[model samples]
Target: MEKKAVYPGSFDPFTNGHMDIVRKASAIFDRVYIVMAVNSEKRRAFDCRRMQEAMERALADSGIRNCEVSIYDGLIAEYTKHHGIGYMVRGLRNNMDYNYEENIAEVNKLIDPSLEYVYFRADNVAVSSSMVKELRHYGQDVSSYVPPAIAALLADGNTER
Candidate 1:
């Protein structure tokens, strides 16, 4: 059986940390689906399509061939179960992230008992979507934190690329 894993997240702007996880996960899983979760309750900084395009470009540039990027609007647990994907991947930077992710994992398990969670520690603990946004807001270069495509999007300042 082919090993498939789902890495679901908001990915407001795909950061280098996210790229790191994708690079590593693609190595082990036969297929790694980078699912972008769309939550109505949360406000996002960038358009979903634009973010997805940027991510796709970055992933392509990195030569990660075993991954696909898609947008889904619902609970990831339900998405995984409905798609028959058993494993889900997450990235953790610190204790706070672990605690929060663990809580989500528990809830996901309740929703789909067959679902399993895999966690990867981020290469740079300081990289986060919020930090990227803040730095960009201050007119600081965030190229080091986010992927090149994402950095271009951020530097463009809401203009379509």
Candidate 2:
């Protein structure tokens, strides 16, 4: 059986930090799914289709051939089980992220006991989706924080500059 892992996140603008984790996971797993999570309660900067498309382009441009981009509306744990993925990839920047992800991992464990987690420390601890969006909101250049495709997408609607 192929070792497949799913990396789920809002990925509002698939940041460099996210790419770093995917790179790490792809190196270990036979396949890595970059899942764009849909949360109804949260207002998204971009739609799922757009996010997935941009991520696909980014992954391709980065020459990450073993990773696929997908969108998931339901629980990620369910998505992994339904797709026969046995691993999940997560990125940690600090203690706060550790606490938050730890709680979510526990819940996912209850839903799928066989699912395992692989964590990668952030390559750049200061980078995050929220920070990228905020910088774009102010018309600041965000090319360094995100992949080329995502940076272009975020630059499209940024009218401040």
The best candidate by TM-score is 1
Largest lDDT belongs to which candidate? 1
**lDDT (CA) for every model shown?**
0.89, 0.88
Off by over 4 Å in 2: 158-161
lDDT of 2 by residue, 72-120 (tens): 7899999998999999899999999889999999999999999998889
lDDT by residue for model 1 (1-161), tens: 98889999899888999999998899989999999999889888888898998999999988899999999998998888888888999999999989999999999999999998899989988998889888877888889898888888777766332
True-vs-predicted CA distance for residue 35, candidate 1, Å: 1.0
Give model 1's TM-score versus the native structure.
0.95
TM-score of each: 0.95, 0.94
Error of 1 at 36 (Å): 0.9
Model 2, position 95, has a per-residue lDDT of 93
